[model samples]
Target chain A: MADLIALDDARDERLRDYTDLRDVQLRTTVEQERGIYIAEGEKVIHRAVAAGHTPKSLLLAPRWLDNLSDVLEATDAPAYVLTEKAIEQVTGFHVHRGALAAMQRPQEREPREVLAAARRVLVAEDLVDHTNIGAIMRNAAALGFDAVLLSPRCADPLYRRSIKVAMGAVFSLPWARLDDWYGAPALLRELGFTTYAMTLADDAVSLEDVEPAERAAVIVGSEGPGLTEHWQREADHRVIIPMAAGIDSLNVAASTAIACWHFSRR
Target chain B: MADLIALDDARDERLRDYTDLRDVQLRTTVEQERGIYIAEGEKVIHRAVAAGHTPKSLLLAPRWLDNLSDVLEATDAPAYVLTEKAIEQVTGFHVHRGALAAMQRPQEREPREVLAAARRVLVAEDLVDHTNIGAIMRNAAALGFDAVLLSPRCADPLYRRSIKVAMGAVFSLPWARLDDWYGAPALLRELGFTTYAMTLADDAVSLEDVEPAERAAVIVGSEGPGLTEHWQREADHRVIIPMAAGIDSLNVAASTAIACWHFSRR
Candidate 1:
């Protein structure tokens, strides 16, 4: 059981981790330097606990502590109980969810190792938006994609906003960054995987037409300049989702979800 | 040709529609009262103009006016050319996109009309997030979904934020609100459409097992508290996208895209 500590002062030193959250640079720098990230809301905190992430401490309103007694019992971290007003004052915003947890960032496994045992994987290239990156991971986790591989330009999945947007699935999903897009396809092929690059080209094969294989990698690119020509040329197959007359393409995240679901079905 | 009206004064009464935009209440009131919306970026502006939306006016930096000669040639509305500094002062933010357009809201078609000629339609119930609403429209347009039907609780599709996030596809896609959910499904059935409701129940049929039909309606609910029990019971088919071991469901927009593509393929 976790120790419950009562905090009356909004400026307590122990609450430094939850302060000045609106400043992106300061928050990200703190995360990188201290190797910790904050997870907000009761649902996400519960997911983090279920995924076996160790919580350094939990900040919650007294009302939430009383309401979420069962959840508090499952974790061994100290709980800092404060008034709703005090909690809001420290966080620089109204966190209506009432409960938050600061947890250590767990080390991730290499992409090759994750792919070695995977049947279906999602490869994201230069997806710079953190929310999109998080949504892709959430969709991948929900649709049975075994893992996600990110190119060098992808946003940090552990960023505060990404974790919040992902609903904590980022903590459970297997992800790693690949430094070299030029050589990554060769490594995937060596691992018995067929690569499919998603594109909007007229000549590209329909996603439904691709035959199921034992292992496959679905490659998605950034929003504007989709998959680069170099990567598309090297892909084992280029697949397109047939669109309506006036529409050109779906958002990258939406397209990725459709492609992932199709791959999962196969 | 659009009359190039160079305005040096930030307080020009003619620019009232584009002033103090950072005020949320004022913007929302204008949206509700005037029923007008703003579209940003050169590409979206071009698409909106091409879609026959009458431009009320165009606000552009002096540097961008030179590049917009072709666009100006097609419209007779006054184009207010301002310096970058003046543009920022008027809009209450840095105007990096260099161009913006104000458009009068076009009249909407009835939901029944949009569905009558459609082979496939998406019914969104109580999805209030503007971004999700926009993304869903973008996906529906791209995946060949014929039209969209929104329940009364859904957000306004013509809202400014939704228009921007949708990349102007909202103007091209056909959509309307359905005041009656119960009667609507029955109407759809009478029209020879198979209604499929997405749910997370264990007994629901896998999406892969849903046979293709000539006419189909895929119903989706808000992020949490998925399809209402009434919708689930009323639907002709309950389809589940097979997920991984521990995950629950995909994001609403992501799931909608997958379902739309599946229906289009069939």
Candidate 2:
């Protein structure tokens, strides 16, 4: 069982991880440096623990202690009990679910390990928005994509907002960032996966027209400019979701969902 | 051409329509009562004007004036020029695009008028999030669904955030809100549309298995509860996008995108 520590001050040094949760820029850097990721609410905390992540500490409202007792029992981490008002002051937002955990960040997995047994995969390139990363993770997992591979600059899937939006899919979906994004297409091909680059190029084949392969990797790009020319040229196939005339493209998350659905194995 | 009027005060009574934009509850009530909607940024403002929504007034920084001169030349509405800091004070947030317009809300169109020529349509039921509504509009428009029909309680697609997220697709897509929520399914059927309710029921047919109808209307529900039992039973078919086991469902916008793509006429 966890040690229950009652705290009255929001400025306590132990509550550092829970501070300024709304400041994405600052949280991203600080969390990374601290080697921790925040798991918000009961469900996400449970998922994180279930996924083999160790909790460094937990912050909970007095009312939520019993509700998350099972989770607390699973970890020896110190559980700080405080008023909901104090939580809001510390976190810069109301703790809607009244439970939070600062989990020890898991070691990064190699691409080879993540894709080794996967039959279908999603390769994300430079997706900057954490929400998009979370949504994409949910879409890919729900649609039966076995794993995900991210380009070097992709947003952290474990970001609190991403984890919340993904509803714990980020915990279950196996993903790894590529150290060398330029060679991703070739690497996937070497791993016996046929790669499909999603783009809006005029000559690209319609997504519906592409035949499903035994091992397939669908590459999606950043929100603004889309797939880099390097990935677009090197991927085995360039696919487009045929859109109505004059519409530029579907939102990245939306298009990823459609692509994942179109190539779903189930 | 619009008369360029300089304003130093954020609390000017003439800027009533542009106040408290970050406060959703207050803005929604106030804007609806005043029969006006805010179009944020350069692109959305232009789209609103092009969609025949008369601009009551425009708030812009001096830097944005030249960029929007063509639009100013097209309307007789007074343009209020102010510093970016003053705009922040008025709107309660930084106006990144440095331009905003208060456009007269177009009178609600009848369902029949919106669906008369649309072979494929989307029916949204109580989707409370403006961003989701906007995304759904962009998806439907991009995927070739010609019109949208909203439940009485659905969020306004012309809300500033929605318009920005949708990239002004709301201005191009024909949409109407149903007066009688209970009679919506029957009304669509009466208008020659075969309604398909998207649900996660065990007995629901897979979306891919359902053949496309000549006149199809896909109905999606609110974020949490999904399609109500009433709509699910009354619609011609209950269709589901088959998902991996243990996963609940995709984000509404993502699911809507997949559904729109599957049922696309083009």
Best lDDT among the predictions, by candidate number? 2
lDDT minimum window of 10 residues, candidate 1 chain A: A66-75
Candidate of highest DockQ: 2
lDDT per residue, candidate 1, A61-125, as tens digits? 97788655876787787899998889889999988899988887777668788887899999999
Off by over 4 Å in 1: A1-15, A67-90, A179-182, B1-13, B19-26, B70-76, B81-92, B179-182
lDDT of 2 by residue, A48-118 (tens): 99889999999999998888888888889999999999999999999899999999999999999999999
Expressed as tens digits, the lDDT of each residue in B1-266 for candidate 2 is: 99999999999999889988989999889988999999888988887888888999999999999889999999999999999999999999999999999998999899989999999999999999999999999999999899999998999887888888888899889999998999988888898889899998879999888887899999999868999989989999999988998888888999999999889833
Query: What DockQ was computed for model 2?
Result: 0.81
Badly placed stretches (over 4 Å) of model 2 are none
Taking every candidate in turn, the Cα RMSD to the unseen true structure, in Å, is 3.0, 1.1
- Clash pairs (backbone) in predicted model 2: none
Error of 1 at B141 (Å): 0.7
